[model samples]
Target: MAQLGNIENLIAARELLTSSLEKSKHLASAIDKTGRKLEEINQRLPSLEAAIKTLASKCSLSEIGRHIDPTVGPAAAVLNVFDAVHMLEESLSADPCSNLFRYLSIVKQLEEALKFLTDNCGLVIRWLEDAVRFLEGNAVVDDDRYLLNLNKCLRILEELRVTEEHSLLSGGCLCAAYGKLESEFRRILMENSFPLPMASSSVSVGEQACIASLPFPVPVIQKLQAIIEKLTTSNRLEKCISMYVEVRSLNARATLQALDLDYREISLSEFDSVQSVEGYIDQWCKHLEFAVKHVFELEYKLCENVFEKVGSDVWMGCFAKVTVQSGLHDFIKFGNTITKGKKDAIKLLKLLDIFAALNKLRLDFNRLFGGKACVEIQTRTRDLIKKVVNGASEIFWELSVQVELQRQSAPPSDGSVPRLLSFVTDYCNLLLHDNYRPILAQVLEIHRSWDHAKFEEELLSHEVHDIIKAIELNLETWAKTYEDTTLSYLFLMNNHWYLYKNLKGTKLGDLMGDSWLQGHEQYMEYYATLYLRESWGKLPAMLSEEGLILFPGGRAIDHDLVKKRLEVFMDAFDGMYKKQCSWAVSDKSLRGKACQLVVQIIVPAYQKFLQTYMPWVQQEASPSRNTKYSAERLKNMVCSLFQPKLGMYGSNTCTNMMGNINNAAINQLSSTPAAA
Candidate 1:
């Protein structure tokens, strides 16, 4: 079994060796065939290389000669470009101001040439940029010299572009041309622009006839538009825009100045009084309306027409510059000055007028200054409106403060209406007029909304009520200044009557309502009664029957006692007449009623007392010696009590009259038979 296994292993090893030898022979044969093919390929290599070289040369030559003019070679084309650049430089050398149309034509040619170069010479531009980058120390791999050499046209272009002489001819000359265009733009604008007509006194003239149309003539606008197109094409739009702003701004300012709307030159101190500024305020309103509605409106139209092809931002910037430089700031500044000036009740009315004027023009302001470029104007205008609203509101509330201050002043000694009272009532009357009522109502409503977080339509009425209440309190305080209770009551009656009489049938009366009117009426009546009671109510008591006695069942009268009472009554009547006669009631009807009240209280009582006792006293003496005042005389004296006895109430004549009356009363009393 071992011998047979050995024989099988030898047979397996021989079969494996035979299979390996067959595979090696096939491999050697394949290797020999591959080497033969390699030798054959090597024999054709040089000829194929020579053929490829010929094809590459032909392709390069074809690419270089493709667009070459048969008559004008690449060299001539380059020279032609240089000639075109030289011609552009020479054309730019001519002043644009001399002939702006001709100059603009030349600039248009330059723009077209630049655009053509940019479109056709992109690769040359990149190469030149790369070369410039390498020169500037940036890493860059240079392209092949043959490729670079093939594009001689583009290479020359790059060379011409980098040269200082070409730069001066192209960039520098074009800049000078743009500079000339800017000057021409300014000159054309200045020549064509004219001041707008002076504003009419009437504000209802919404805009001037010229404002409805373009301010510039058609030819001038076209010329300006042409110049703008050239400048825009050259990417010099900012220069043109700045020039337009400068020229047109001056024109707008001139127009406003012609309308007398140059508020910056004005001084508030030029006016003699706050009231004197009313005319200026009126003028301000009219001129401001004209400026916004006419001058600026025209300017906006001009900007739109001239820069219509330009972007809105550019035109808006130009318009904004013109509007601001043309005294719009000064107009608002003037208003601010007025609001920030002296605070007074009268100034409140002025501020309301200013507010109304500005408020009226709010839509115009928004329309004109709505752009981002006019943001400062919009903000300042809104701020001024706020200032006017707050200032007018503050001054409106100062009515109460003024009343409180008036309380410190002396009351009218003649029991007439206090000046402060009349001032307040008159001021309120003005405020409640048709022109100011709605405006003030709106202002106060907004003010309340800001301060109290609430709004009410009756806000103005409430404010008026508060002011009236303050005036009433002040009247009360003033009344106390009079030492005589009668004059004090008379003072209250006079002021209340004055207020009611002046305010009746007016808007203010309607606001105060019937209840308020009735209340004031009752107040006047109550004070009138007090005056009568205090002045004459006690006179009747002096004649009362308590002190008198009838002896033996009224058959005999006590003559001594009655005579002594009569003497005392005469003395009291004489003293009261002298002292009370000087006090005055300024209102006619009020004075009449007041005098009648005194007569009603004392005259009937004294007359009846005389009817009973005068004859008893007369039995001892004549009537003249027995009684200084008869019923008729007492009635006459009472009727004359409230009349102004001298010139004016507080005048020297009034003082002399009081002194003379007192002296006469003293002399008459001392010489009387009762005193003797």
Candidate 2:
């Protein structure tokens, strides 16, 4: 019975053990099923999160658009949304999932805001257009509101592009939006007109000055600049700056054309205006260059494109226009300025002013472009020189005519010949070689061996050649004016001698040169010879063979006939003395020489007449004698014939002739029958 009860206990313990084992297997299978379901639930979690992210993106986008108050102004609504998106972007950034959705929401709402700006806020552009239309019609209108809205729209668009890369919807490029804003901005600028800057200021300083009416007048330029700033901030500078540069360049060109630079009217007063035409052009250039450089400074990559498109054209075309127009009137005025107060209002012709102007122009152009620009105007330079010369020539012709008239109205002794010649030579000296010293030195060095042809060949210019010819012609005309050959010769001799002596080391000497000096010396000699023949040649004719007294009755003298012949000769001497004493011989040496020549001819013949008749002189000792002029008395009278101004040289010739006469008288007495 105990064994059977223990077996039952064992069987019950076995059954309990088997039941525990089966329950354990069931619990293991249930744990396996739960693990499978948990794995499946874990696999579905990412999809749920993705769905939540998509929903959050839509909701965030809805919130952003709702917060944008359309009732408030469009610019204000866009500003509110832009501000909200920025805060959301910062707060949600730690969770990439939320951040991604936040960024998408920002782009979507910003796009719609930009669309509002494009469609509804286009009233800003319309206002700009109206302002431009008013300006185009020659009436200025305020555009401050338009510009402000434009700036706001551009600001929002730029902020949107700056958000995360995936924020923008499909086909939404910030650059494309930039392109639209830039186009409208440029259109307004193109249509509007602004006055040239009228203040006296430098380029850098002027750029800081506000146009009292329009501080940022050219929104086209300003908008383009804003776009460049946006692109450059986003590191997309090179991709879009070139297009902006090209558009800005085209606008600048159009503005230049509208200014009518080519048809600009310049006058003397305009040239002399306080704000010169050049100043106006300078202001224009500064405005254009500032626009170009401002854009370039926003992105350094734009420098080359800016210069190629607009900078070079501004320098060579628009800048060149200012130079050409200003130079035209200014050059003529420059020529006129120097020539004032001159003889006939034309005597002083100098190219120095023109040369100085040209130099200034070159330096100004170099400075304008910082020595990087090149322009050619050689033909214009030549034309300027030609105009000066031609204008001067007209004045010269008038002066020459005046000189001729003055000379014709006066005698050779009036000094007009010398004065006019001096003026002409001095003028040529200053004009031809640019200085008078070289001409002065060259002329003073002239000598007998100087060659005329060689000297003329070395002369400065054709104008100089013509001037010298005129001088020679005047000299010839003045010399030939005197009726008496002796007086004519005297006139030429005095003038030529004076010129030759006084012109040395002077401007006239240089102009006349060595050959002229040598020729003058020859002229002096020729005239002196002619004077000798004229004054003295007639004295010998009075003592010709026909004039001789022949006493057929050797012992008796024909007292009346001999006395009459002596009186005839004395009367001729008196007449000759009276005439020559008044005639001028300025040089002391020349006066003495002339007196000696006259005495040599007259005294010898007179002595011969006295000697031939003196044999009968002592025979007829009447108180009123036929030969009344004793040798000593004749000598004394002849010495008194020359004017006191002739000095010792004029007296000595007569004194020596007296000695000859006394010796001849003594010899005649010795040969006579009375002395033997």
Residue-wise C-alpha lDDT for candidate 2, range 1-676, written one tens digit per residue: 1222332343343333322324334433443453344345346545633543454445433332222222224334333333433333333234222233333333334444344334433333333333233223432134233333334444444444344343433334543433444444345434543432433444353345433333233433444354445445445554453343444355334433433344233433434221123343333334333322332122222233222343454324433333333233333344343323223321222223333344335444344433222233344444454543443444443444444454453343422224344445444445544343242223322311143323342434544556557666777787677677677777677666655665656555676678888788788778878877877567766645353435554455556666677777777777776666556654556556666666677778888877877666557657345555665666556555434342311221212322222222112111111110
Candidate 2 achieves a global lDDT of: 0.43
Clashing pairs in 1: none
Candidate 1 lDDT tens digits, 1-676 = 1222333443344343322324434433443453344345446545544543454445443442222222113222333333444445565777777767766766665554443343324433443333333223322135243333334444455555443334426457666677777878888887787776543545443344433545678788888899888778667788788878888888777776665554445665654333546667777887788788778898898899899898888888899988887778888888877766566565677788898888888899888899999999989998888888887877776566656665676777777775455556656767877788889988887887778767666666777778788888888888888888877888888777876776778777788888888788888888887876776777777777664766545657667677777777778778878877767776777778877877787788878888888667666647678767778887877777677645443221212322222222122111111110
- Alpha-carbon TM-score of each model against the true structure: 0.64, 0.35
333: Cα error in model 1, Å: 2.5
Clashing pairs in 2: none
Clashes of 2: 0
Stretches of model 1 off by over 4 angstroms after superposition = 1-72, 84-102, 114-159, 162-172, 199-213, 259-280, 394-408, 518-585, 588-676
TM for candidate 2 is 0.35
Report the C-alpha displacement of residue 8, candidate 1, in angstroms: 99
